[model samples]
Target: MTDTPDTLLDGTHTVLTPEYVEFRFTLAGIYSRFLAWLLDTLIVMVGTGAILSGLSMAMMVFPGFASALGFVIYFLVDWGYGIALETAWSGRTVGKRVMGLRVIQRSGVRIGFYHAALRNLARPVDRLPFLYLVGGVAALLSGSYQRLGDMLAGTIVVRERRLKAPSAIGAAAGEGLLADPLFVSRVKRLSAEARELVLSAALRREELRMEARLRLFSALGTKLQELLAMEKPAHLSDEKWTLLVAAALIPAPGARTSTGARAVA
Candidate 1:
């Protein structure tokens, strides 16, 4: 068990990745989690109402199949809903999005389909002894505020802070000529996901603590280094290298780009 840093406020935990980059995540407390869950339940109820109405119509027409169809609808609305939305929205259901919350892997990356499935599948177990009594206790006692499913699935819920400034490639300003055209090409070749990470790190750079910032950039820079197939210059901070990559990747004006760029398109 990792010790929670003294500097951290209550309900916050730090994750140190393999790249030695450490990030602080604020664990979603029971109150907020309950609120988010309540919102989701309401959504599920609405969906259930629609399904029930349809089922009622179907039953009147074909009474023999009513019970089975009703059961199927019940299962789907109760279970399938979360799985579908979380997977599709990258761990954000309608409720989570509204509440500014997200489910992510313990390591801080986005959760995969398998992770989503595993967590939701374990939902029944979490509800043991009624009203999430078992799960709530587990979360209250756990270091990372993990319920049984989250622990089993190696996932956690965290607060998703909205960036004050756009955390997009085009928002980053270039300094002088780019480091190398080859590097620029490499940056261009980066996967959309990787680029998003770089953009996010750059935009949120000012918000991170010094140690946390270094770790994050170091980790991201190392990954970028591998993609570029070269070592980063020692003098330039890891973050600077990441920013440089962002700048290089940003298509200049006359370029339509996402992340609030002035490009046409």
Candidate 2:
């Protein structure tokens, strides 16, 4: 699933999931991402400046406590700045927001505190030997334009955009093949919630963001593969397989509609 700019279609990286969702994220290039990092650094510097100013004033009043306070502020400003802002702002610090960039899971999942922490914790490594030289090389060479921190965190930087529902189902719209008896049995074995989840995703596949659709279908496809104790044919995409399974389990009208259903995020 790794994709470099050279492999991108019309300069956009496509993330496909087994659920038939496809997300086309325009990767934030090394230069833009660096600029955003610089902005965040400036913010950190401002906070540091304020803390130092306060510490200097306090040093005259309480010289003993000044040293301790400086150390604490230094640690917090160096690390806590990024962690606190990213966790609270859904992966955006002041610089990222200003640069119209955001951090998100490569798989299209929402980032959590753990992800933010992991990425930030690895920041020092990314900065090894100076001005993010290691991270710069990694981003330039890696598919998804990821730095070491992003790779460690399974995250990516993408330009922010409004998520719009698709007007029609793209890959999810197709005639499903008849289910094999074994496949049918496997389908029946799934829990009601699981079955309904697949059906719902299939029904609303058209309206989902490409990345989300791909993720859903990929996950469902893997689940089906496990249940059926079979491997997917190389020719069949995850969405196709999941749709076939959905068709077998749900034969209701409009289940295979050419026009996609409106999806609610």
Highest lDDT, which number? 1
RMSD of 1: 6.0
Question: Cα miss at 192, model 2 (Å)?
Answer: 22
lDDT of 1 by residue, 1-265 (tens): 2434422433775666565555566667787788888898888888877888966876889888888887677657868888998888778888887877788887667777888988888888998988888899999899888999999999998877644434433433544437467777777888856875676567656757788787788878788889889788777767777888877765666776654321100
* Per-model TM-score versus the true fold: 0.74, 0.57
Residue-level lDDT for 106 in candidate 2: 79
Give per-model CA RMSD. 6.0, 10.4
Kindly list the per-residue Cα lDDT of model 2 for residues 1-265, writing each as its tens digit: 5554533531455666554556556777777788888888887878887978966876788888887887677657868988888888777888888877788787655477888998898888989989999988998889788889889899988776533322222333354434357666776677644664565567656657777777777888888888768787778899787776665664345466432221212
Candidate 2 regions off by >4 Å? 1-11, 58-72, 163-265
Clashes of each: 1, 17
Model 2 weakest lDDT span, ten residues long:
163-172
lDDT of each: 0.73, 0.70
